[model samples]
Target: MFLLPVLLLLSSCQETIESKDWDTIEMPRVSVHDPSITSVTEDGEEVFYIFGSHLAQAKSKDLVNWEVPFQTEYEDLDNNIILGDIDKNLREAFEWAGKDDADSAGGYSIWAPDVIWNPNYKWKNGDKGAYMYYYSATSTWRRSNIGFAVSKTIEGPYTYQDTVVYSGFTQVDSTDGSDRNTHYKNTHLKKLISTGVIDEFSSNWVLNSGTEYNTDYAPNAIDPTLFYDENEKLWMVYGSWSGGMYILPIDEKTGIPMYPGVDSENQGLIVDRYFGTKLIGGYHQSGEGPYIVYDKETQSYYLFVTYGQLHSSGGYNMRLFKSDNPDGPYVDMKNQVPVFSSTDQNSQYGVKIMGNYQFSNMNKAYKSSGHNSAIITEDGQWMLVYHTRFTGGESHEVRVHPMMMNRNGWPTTLPFEYVNNEYFVSEVGDKDIIGSYEFINHGTTNDPKVLPLSTVELRADKTITGDVSGTWDKEAQSSFISFVIEDVHYEGIIVMQQDETKEQTKKIVFSAIGDNNQTIWGVKK
Candidate 1:
């Protein structure tokens, strides 16, 4: 009985990682947040550009070395990307959409810029092939707009196209109006009415009111991400906090939702709340920063999300979920589905892949390692581009690390950032598994301080003794190891990571999660 589930978990954890692909490259030290990376080949040399919050862009020939160049090939792109620059009629437009900024400033911040090559729409304007879509908003939780911009080149002076969709803009005319066209009276809204969510749509029904930004009919429109599905259909997954996440079909030609102006209550119904698939949310827990990457090789769409507070509080961490389809009911390692009302299960659903961590040769421990993006390089290197703040540091710095899938199709990140060191993947046996290790428990809490590494020991006699307490065992044919730590069963695989500070020394590492949804990471000491 236990063997079948163990086999399923172990098989999903294995991934084909080439040792040669682990190039010893060091990414530049820079402060940026919500990074999105794209690669382009110009004149036989491949280059990558990283875009982030506050309209920041950094260019790199190799993923490691970077330069913040404003002037590219075609244009000298402007630095300060203000909201007024993108759209002049900000107040009129947002009032028409029925959403207000978190602050009275009417939305000024640009965040999580996603740039991609739109082949279908490239020739229409006689320009280059890239389109950039970004979020502009105030500190307001639910008030935001996903705007469109186009550039002939990757490094762009991106021309603001138009506002795609406003999150809280359901009733078009909230003020005392004569006759106004609202999204509630639209066809999509009619469909949602048929689903029994909204019985009879009134202008008052569309109006949102709440202190927590949860009274809105739609999902919070921040953190926009764009990607094409297996059928070549362009789709977007967006939302943060309040109403959880949502998915909308994108019209390739217009660079917006297929049903653009329709404001049905069904707008936010696709993910984890009223009517949506509910990617990941908890009872008032922070569940934001949604990015989905479809790995063609695995035939699975991997959903990467950040949870907890995304501040220096050290609660922020990156987690993962995978599904066979793009619009999913995504499942995590334990096959637990994300629930909206329950704060317990969703907190433990996805594997906590990255968090406040410390390695051998670090000046300080890394905290709040979330809000990330992933890409497969032209040379087939899988990388996670993210921002992390060190202990006692005030600003967030960008970092890139290799992301490899396990035999069970789950992804795990390396302990250290990408540096000039080689990692090893050796066959594991009982001898390799028995050792003293430094372990840290990524507990599901909002604590600001990262847990200190605790020492644990694994005995060769199938008995376990550690900082906590447990019995250890391993499968005969695979590297799948499990142990009971304080009555909570934990399972994971043994892999090797190199310590560059010690003559590039290699150490066995284990990353596992308990049945209670807590994650345990260990490195051989």
Candidate 2:
């Protein structure tokens, strides 16, 4: 058969990942966080940045680590970002609070912030169409209201706007007092409204289950975040302490809350309190950073919390729970409790131990590493970003670590070590720490089967055992055999390459045991 030039070319053409593509690369963030940061996350080439009324910083990275070179307040806006001077209203809004410093937010103390593109508007001119919303507390002792900011790109030098919405009033300029903006009228939000970015949320409504299902959003409720469901509708979930969290449908037309009023008319309803009921208390045992995450793999929703008291010794810890819905009946998977916790005696604290000991490698000041939010990398690895106190009494710094669900479906921060090595990789495939390979029975004649991938155990004397044990150079490269203090059978995947340029990879699984304070490899499984 004769083939045309085009047909021949098509027949010969195939996609190939060069050996260079097989290079074992990893997620770029080593420890990304803003000081006193409530959340650290990514959306695009930009690492969208906002801190607790402290600073607004952004990082841009193409492949690996985010490069954070942009940090600004109102003054640096136009020069560094797209929508810098465009939001004249935002400048007028923040003029009073004196956003120059959190301690001196004029009267506004900026809190939990969420940044996303302006869904309603496409990028053009300098307005790349990004927006930010944050809960702002005027004082440490009072309730705070959510504020607004607008920018061009996800990596923003967002323009400082005014406190469009606030707690404590329905209409800041009410005459007769029947404006029906009551959803925000009574709460700390009073009647302030958040301008939820258009693209990030659902523009939908729920069928009435009961009057208790307000489904109305509030401006005053704290820790507000604008998110979208898989269906691409815009939704806003916000609230703090006394009211719990609420989810309300949004008006795509105006970026405002859409709710049915008492008249069953557009009396303007609010979101139903989604998490903990009034009787149930806050989502966290107390409610601080009520961040939500969606698991694409399981199609489940996760609400993460920074629980307990960081002021106490060994108190602060990052905790989380899951549910089938975004606005959920979030339950702590580990305990079936209402909220996530690590108060358990055996393995309560969920902070990632950086070295052999908590105080050994990390800063000794382990006062708190709580307030957390979850993010998935572009490559799809889950990471939890939280702040840990410096061990030696330094300023609280933020850190990022890979996270995962345990065999029990509960979430756990990646441990500090893997395969007995201090640093660990969190990718799959013939990459650094995952791949299919052979197993050699070296530990006694029992030759018990290893967990899944090839596994070997090394005794306390530091020797390989179980399936296979030999001086073979190849086995060492492909995998490793390690052990814990209990001197039981343990194994791990050792990422080795043939002089660092080969695509070959292997999985070496091992077992270990230990209390929460330590790990000891034991038993097969």
lDDT of 1 by residue, 45-141 (tens): 8778777775556777766566764332112112232222323423333443332223323224456777877876644556535655555443345
**So what's the TM-score on candidate 1?**
0.76
- The window of 10 residues in a row where model 1 has the poorest summed lDDT is 1-10
Cα lDDT of model 2 by residue, 1-525, tens digit: 000000000011113211111111233332323222223345434342434322233342322243343322322322323223322423333332223323332222344556544456333453333454443433211123555555443444454444533332322322111222222234322222233222211222111321111222222245556566656566556554333345555444344554422112111223232121211122223434556667677777666654444332334544455667655555542224342223323123222122111311223333456556566655665666665554444245445554544333334444322111123332322232222223321211111122122444433333445554422111233333233323332323232211111221222223221122222222222
Report model 2's TM-score to 2 decimal places. 0.53
Q: Which candidate number has the best TM-score?
A: 1
What is the lDDT for 110 in model 1? 52
Residue 317 error, candidate 1, Å:
1.9
Of candidate 2, the 10-residue stretch with the lowest lDDT total is 1-10
| Runs of candidate 1 exceeding 4 Å displacement | 1-27, 42-46, 70-107, 126-128, 170-217, 260-278, 282-284, 342-348, 359-361, 421-423, 426-433, 471-493, 500-505, 513-516
CA lDDT of 204 in candidate 1? 28
Error of 1 at 76 (Å): 11
